[model samples]
Target: MKNNLTKMMALDIYVSNLEEEKYSEITTELQPSSKKSVNLISWGIQDLFFEKELFNDLDTIKTFSKNFNWKDNVSTVIKENYYESLVLTDAEKKIIWVSNGFTKMTGYEKEFALNKTPRFLQGKETKETTKKRIQKKLQLGKPFKDVIINYRKDQSTYKCELHIIPLHNSSNSKITHFLALEKEAV
Candidate 1:
């Protein structure tokens, strides 16, 4: 048990160091220190493989895990020479992945929203046509992109033009995942 805890702590430290290094070389408009600290604790808790009690006691761990894609967003920003973006999941619909230029546009850190569903971006005024389009594509294992009104957590709406591609896992025709991208409309 002690050895396991030690290993968990070691791995957590390694991941935290990597994150710190990455943040240091990247964005300067904000400090990711708070997010990093939460992530470090989350990693340690997960490594320990404790019970639900411990897990929920540090609900931030779950929050951090869900937002794990911020790392990807940061890397993408660097690679594409953009500012920021968001990645989402359709966990209820079957693990669909989606992303938006959030950091580049909105100020929310990816760590604060790792496992969030893109529906969080939806608004009361958002057209059903757009939802239908997404459903059609999701059903047919096809990819599609369109412009629509999307809301942020702050109740502010913005026009988002986005696209998605279905990823198949097998030559036998098994769909494994969907990768979606959202870009702010001009």
Candidate 2:
């Protein structure tokens, strides 16, 4: 048991270092060649393995929220609804992060969803009125809950319940990001 624990600790440290390196690479501007190298490293097998293992862990999620300087309310919402698939977006509505459950629920990989708007999940069957309502709510910078038909990567439709919260920068009280806790509506 002690040996196993030691191995686990070592693996955790290695993964942590890799995550820091990836974050550094992402934040730093790089030449095209360096960017390609970073992409290769970012999408390597170990990244996939560790991200899958770590993302579902509640403690890891809490640490992630804190590390990214998310507001208390944002962290609370995330902690309370951790079981639900989470989609976090920049103020512009571009996806910045997603829980592993999001991929499981939508059949879309994290890489595919990153930097894209949640509208990618909508299809012809999605109501225009509902979309407009969601946009308006977002514009108002308020938390709201709504249900809409959303398509998966395979184009299958599902009724998705979205609890959307606009996060603010605690220092400035300005909108920083949006968090959506989502689940399939039965």
CA lDDT of every candidate? 0.49, 0.74
Worst 10 residues of 2 by lDDT: 30-39
Against the hidden true structure, what lDDT does model 1 obtain? 0.49
Q: Which stretches of candidate 1 lie over 4 Å from their true place?
A: 1-100
Q: Model 2, 147: alpha-carbon shift in Å?
A: 0.5
- How well does candidate 1 match the true structure in TM-score terms? 0.46
lDDT at 8, model 1? 52
Cα displacement (angstroms), candidate 1, residue 100, comes to: 8.7
Per-residue lDDT of candidate 1, residues 1-186 (tens digit)? 567655654543334334457757654633445643322557666445333323332343234334543222222322332112334344245323223345434455555555665665677989999788777757876544556688766677777755554544334445444545565554
Give a tens-digit lDDT track for model 2, residues 29-104.
Answer: 4223434322355557745654454446546446655665666455466555523478889889999888887898
Best by lDDT: 2
